[model samples]
Target chain A: SQQGEEDPQALSIQEGENATMNCSYKTSINNLQWYRQNSGRGLVHLILIRSNEREKHSGRLRVTLDTSKKSSSLLITASRAADTASYFCATDETYFQGAQKLVFGQGTRLTINP
Target chain B: EAGVTQFPSHSVIEKGQTVTLRCDPISGHDNLYWYRRVMGKEIKFLLHFVKESKQDESGMPNNRFLAERTGGTYSTLKVQPAELEDSGVYFCASSPPGVTDTQYFGPGTRLTVL
Candidate 1:
């Protein structure tokens, strides 16, 4: 069973607008990280927020985590056409042999139209 | 520094054939991981390795899938008698020791089982 599920599986906006994606998970997590994938290749790490933290910012990316709600959101301000890609939320949970491993959500596909 | 790398960017094989996918993590990264995204599904963790030792493999689907990391530097995932449901992107990632949450991903191998 997938641990996380992303909402608004697809989103489209103008280049200057902001894009927000939401993710909800089922289990307690050590941290939640967002990633972007372009052309279905490697996934680029965007940002990470620890369970103890509420919000974080890096450049134009903002991430918010709510452990109480078991949810997270990622906001990309001042979106650009180049920002078009698939975004995924990964949650780190306890796995076999006591290793904390990440489980990802179904990605939200965001398209920034120029 | 060079990021993680995966071999045979794409592989097409028959149902009973064998396919081997390789991943080389960044230098000095001893923690390796394997994941995959099936058709229209979320990414799922396959396993984790810590310095040539199998740390976690709870997500591995079955015995037909074998993952090995030699010398804690590079890893390989072999699928014997690949099934149609196995066609998807196989991704490998590595994180430096003690940084288990932030992972660097490799360009995934697109496995197409015909």
Candidate 2:
């Protein structure tokens, strides 16, 4: 069974607008990370938030994690056409001995229209 | 500073045939992982290796799928007697030791079992 599930499987917005995607997980996690995949490309690391951290920001990306709700969100500000891609949220569950493997969620497809 | 790399970006084979996918993680990265995404489904973890030792393989679907990392450098995933349900994108990821939160991914191998 998949540990995380992303909400709003698809989202489309103007290039200058902001895009937000949400994810919910079933288990306790050591950390949560967001990744992006361009068409025909590999997944790219975006942002990571530890279970003890509430929010983090990197360039135009902001990520928030709520352990109480077992949910997370990724917000991309001032989206660009190049931001069009699939975003996935992955969880490193604490149950694993070393927490090496990551369980991923069905990605949210975001389209930034120019 | 070469990133993770996977060989044979795309593969097409008939059912019951064997296919081998290779992944070379970033140098010095001991944590190697394998994941796959069936069409329209979430990407699922297949296994993990730390320095040539299998750390966690709880997500492996079955015995037909074999993953190995020789010398703790590069890894390979072999699927024997591939089935139609096995067609999907196979991804390889690696994280630096002690850094389980972020993983670097390689261009995935798209396996199409006909």
Candidate 3:
């Protein structure tokens, strides 16, 4: 079973619109990180919010983590065509010997129209 | 600084054949991880190596898959007698010591089995 699941399997919006994607996890985590994967490319680290942090902002991206709800949301302001990609949320949990592994979600595929 | 790099961006092989994928992490990074994403499925963790030691491999699917990191540097994943279900994108990531939040990913190897 997957530990994290993202909402809205696909999304399409205009260039200037804001895009929001949500992720829900089943267990406690040390931190939740978001990544983007362009077509045929590697995953790019987006933003990470620790379990203790409620919200974080980087450039035009906003990420909020609600541990009580075990959910997180990523908001991309002023979307661009280049932002078209699959966004995934990964949960990092402490394993044996303090080593960690990330459990990823199915991801939300977003397309920004010009 | 160079980012993580993977060789053979794409590979096509028939079932019962062998395929090897390589990943070279950034300089001085000690933590390396492997992940896979099958068609229409979420990316899943395969294994993790900390300086040439198998820190965790709970997500590895089966015994046919072998991974090695010699001298705590570049790593290789070999699949012998590959099955049809083993076809997917193989991603390798690395994080620097003491930093678990961010991981640099390499452009994955897309494996296709006929």
Candidate 4:
């Protein structure tokens, strides 16, 4: 079952603009991670924000977590044409006994028009 | 360092045919995972392997799907008598044992069932 659900099923923006995606999950999690996938390629690990952490940043990417609301958001600043892809948020719903199955959300397809 | 690798970048088969997909994780990575994205839905977890053992397979769809990780170096997922609903992108990922929840993914295998 998919525990996380991403908003803005699709988004289109011009290059140099910022793209923000949001995800909402059902249960408590140890951490939240975001990923990106180019067309016909696998997902690439982005940044992770633990439940205890409210926000984190890597390069031009920023992630904010709100455990009280069971939601997380990813913001990509100064998006490039190459940044056109799908973004997914995964939550660690179960991390017991080494079974860390990441429950993913319905991704957001972001298109950066050049 | 080489990341996770999967064989047969794409496979097309008729319904009811059997297909076996392979995944070779990063060297010395004790954790291996299998996930699939079907149609336009979310990418979902299939199973998790710790070394050579099946640590978790709670998300496997049905008996037609079987996964094995012999020798703990590489893993294989087999679908017996595949159905049209089984068509999707199968991904393989690996992560080292640590506090990090980062998972490196492989170029997924695109499975088409007609």
RMSD of each: 1.4, 1.4, 1.1, 1.4
CAPRI tier for the interface of model 2: medium
Candidate order by DockQ, decreasing, is: 1, 3, 2, 4
User: Candidate 3: misplaced stretches above 4 Å?
Assistant: none
DockQ of candidate 1 compared with the true complex: 0.79
lDDT of 3: 0.93
Which numbered prediction scores highest in DockQ against the true structure? Answer: 1
Local distance difference test values of all predictions, in order: 0.91, 0.91, 0.93, 0.91
Candidate 2 vs candidate 4: the TM-score winner is 4
User: Taking the tens digit of each residue's C-alpha lDDT, what string does model 1 give over B27-92?
Assistant: 999899999999968999999999899988888999999999887789999999799999999999
In TM-score terms, candidate 1 sits at: 0.95
Tell me the tens digit of each residue's lDDT in model 4 across B1-114. 999999879999999999999999999898999999999799998888888887788879999999999898999999998999999999999989652267889999999999
Instruction: Give candidate 4 regions above 4 Å deviation.
Output: B98-100
* Candidate 2: pairs in clash: none
Error at B65, model 1, angstroms: 0.9
- Candidate 1 local Cα displacement, residue B101, angstroms: 1.1
Model 3's CAPRI class is: medium
Point to the candidate with the largest lDDT. Answer: 3
Clashing residue pairs in candidate 1 (N, C-alpha, C atoms within 3 angstroms): none
> How large is the interface RMSD of candidate 3?
1.1
- Candidate achieving higher TM-score, 2 or 3: 3
Per-residue CA lDDT of model 3 for B1-114, tens digit only, reads 999999889999999999999999999999999999998689999999999999888888999999999999999999998999999999999999976558889999999999
lDDT tens digits, residue span A42-75, model 3 = 9999988999999999999999999999999999
lDDT of 4 at B61: 97
